[model samples]
Target: MIFRQICSEKGGSLAYVLGDPVTREAVLIDVAENHLTAAEDFLRSRGLQLRLLLVTHWNASHEQAARALRERWGARLAAHESVHAPCVDMRTRDEDVLYFGEESLRIFHTPALTPCASIYAWNDRLFTGHTILVRGLHPKLHGQARVRLLARLCALLERFPEETLLYPGVENQGRRLSSIEEFRRRSQHGAGGDSADLLQRYRHLLPNKRAAKQREKARAEKNLHRYGPGQDVPASL
Candidate 1:
């Protein structure tokens, strides 16, 4: 099995690479536009073939990249029906299990269809698309439906083992990994709670004006490596 966490410098979004080393079949999750060069180099080096280019959510930052990568890799583009991307070749549904070689990924549809639209589970990791963060900063979602979403998120977190790693959509504090137990403990969300209360408590969650400024500052800061393992690949769109 081959697994990697890639951070796009443009949006600071997290992209993932999951592959069956034995079969040489791979999947790219929310890969970025600037990520193409490195991805190609790595795949070529490993002799891996991309079978699926899966988007947990169709965001502006990744749309062009996804399309370009699909064309370059000739991999099938997969997304939820709600995404409405004409480029998408596979309209995945909730609980849909997609297979590539000997590996499989189970998709779980979430409320926010733009950023945190879906969560994909592969092995012990959960690609939580923007729905989760190690900082316990769940995306600030409007609409009454988020109440249900919060309750559902709590339930989802409960179902997974404490050790299960969470690979969230956006980068948090330059980190790319967390766990169910660590999230529950650090985020101040205990076992179970009322959705309404959860909303009230975390209504101001996600990025605020201050956070945006922080990100801009982080953008100025540079990384040493270009696109090696665990490298933060920064580039403009």
Candidate 2:
């Protein structure tokens, strides 16, 4: 597999280009407008055919690339069904596999960041998006929901190997990657964050059904109020 990690000019953002050596077929992950040219350049330089654009939840930044790549390279855009983007060619589900050449990446639904937020894993590398950051996990969810997110996230991480690599959607202190083992080790000591602190912080909190529903409603709005192909775009777009 061939891979390249592109960082934004101002720098917390990140994007990636991964290609299959055998087929020269590639997929771009979590791309943003700032790095689109750089990403496109790499594809051109390597003579790679962009097969798909897989988004693990980057806000509006993703829209630009989705349109550009689809129009220019004929690449399909895949994302969680709840992702509100007209350019999306595929509505992915949990455990769905996307193939490019001989390589594939599995989708893992993780909606705490946003209803569409997800993670993509291939071989031992995880394109974690905001689900699992390189610096740590700090999702802004309602109390009980936060608890559930932590639990589910832990359960999800456990499914992968300890040495599995994590490529975060956003960079932190110039640190854009970590392994499952490294995240856990840092958590134990408190230098880098882990679910432990989050668990402890919210352990005493009680569930607020009302607040949880309100949060869900807000996310629903994002999905409902977006544009779809050849349709009258929603006001939110």
Candidate 3:
């Protein structure tokens, strides 16, 4: 088996390509349009046929190129069912196993980033899309459901092997890869939580209810300025 990491410098998104040497069949995970040409050329040069194109999650930053790639390459396109788009040829579920010629990949559903967000693990490699970052976790972006997802991910990591290699989404000045053990430790030490709550608690170490109220108050004030007085913006809307 062979692995390739494709990094998008703009959003710090990472895509992957896994290939089987014997069958010369390859699978692409979360490729971006900007990197598509290069990825395809690299695979072709290796005499690998692009068989399966799987998406870990459907954030615009990661999936905008999926449609184009599928159309151009005629490969089977896969994604979480929540993507709810015709572009997806395979609707993936948690623990769904995919075979790329000889290798196997397991999908782990993690709603931390989105309802259908997930990570893909194969062998000792885990392609964690945007669930965790090296610099810090994004609580503000994750919200409430994300916290629950992170906790689950933390637990799942405990079962992973020590040799697991993590390719995180965040770009930092230092380390790039992480082990399951390392991530587990961080999650236990407050890396896993409601992103907004974590930020608020870290800022003042106050209770969630109080921090939430403060967040609402700040939002009200910000919106008041944007739309002027008496233009109450419903929080849900």
Candidate 4:
């Protein structure tokens, strides 16, 4: 397999390009609108035909790019069933296998950060979109709900080999990549302690519901301003 990771200039959103060297077929994951040209250029340079654009979650940025990419490359667009993107040609479910040439990615519905968030695993790498970050996990839920969510996430992660590489949707604090083992070591969610005690210890680290809403509102406003009312911003940004 051939692979490259592209970082968007605006929001440091990460996009992945993976190609099957034997078949010369490729796929893109978490493609950002701003990096569409670059992605196209990379495919052209490699002499690989794009087969699909797989989104990890629904967002303004990805929604806009997905349509343009599909039109340009005639590649199929796929996402979680809960995603309401018009460009999506395929609605994937947990354990669904997406194929491109000889390469295959297994989809895992790992929601909590967003209803449609998912993880794609190929070989030893996991492409986690907003579901898991190098700095911390998404803090959209709190209290007992948060604890249960964390436990669920931990369960899924623990199923993977410790050496598996994690490619997050966005870069945090200049770090864009981590290993499952490393994340498990640094995150409280990885601890064997009870969910209640773990939740208590990490409760302060997560934002309150009100603050999270305010942040979401602010982000929405910012997107509206940047892309104009109905326009789409780059997904990763």
Off by over 4 Å in 1: 113-116, 142-146, 187-237
Per-candidate Cα lDDT values, in order, are: 0.75, 0.81, 0.72, 0.82
Q: What lDDT tens digits, residue by residue, belong to model 2 across residues 143-236?
A: 5665666666666877888989999987887788999888767655654434556667865453455787899999897777553343564546
lDDT of 4 by residue, 32-95 (tens): 7897988999999999999999988888888888888888888999999997666789999998
What range of 10 consecutive residues in model 1 has the weakest lDDT sum?
222-231
Residue 54 alpha-carbon offset, candidate 2, angstroms: 0.8
Residues 19-100 of candidate 3 have per-residue lDDT tens digits of 9998988998878776687788889888888888877667664466777776777788888878787777899888889898
Worst 10 residues of 4 by lDDT: 187-196
Number of the top candidate by TM-score? Answer: 2
Q: Which is superior by TM-score, 1 or 2?
A: 2
Which structure is stronger by lDDT: 1 or 4?
Answer: 4
Provide TM-scores for the models.
0.75, 0.79, 0.74, 0.78
Question: Candidate order by lDDT, highest to lowest?
Answer: 4, 2, 1, 3
Model 1 clash pairs are none
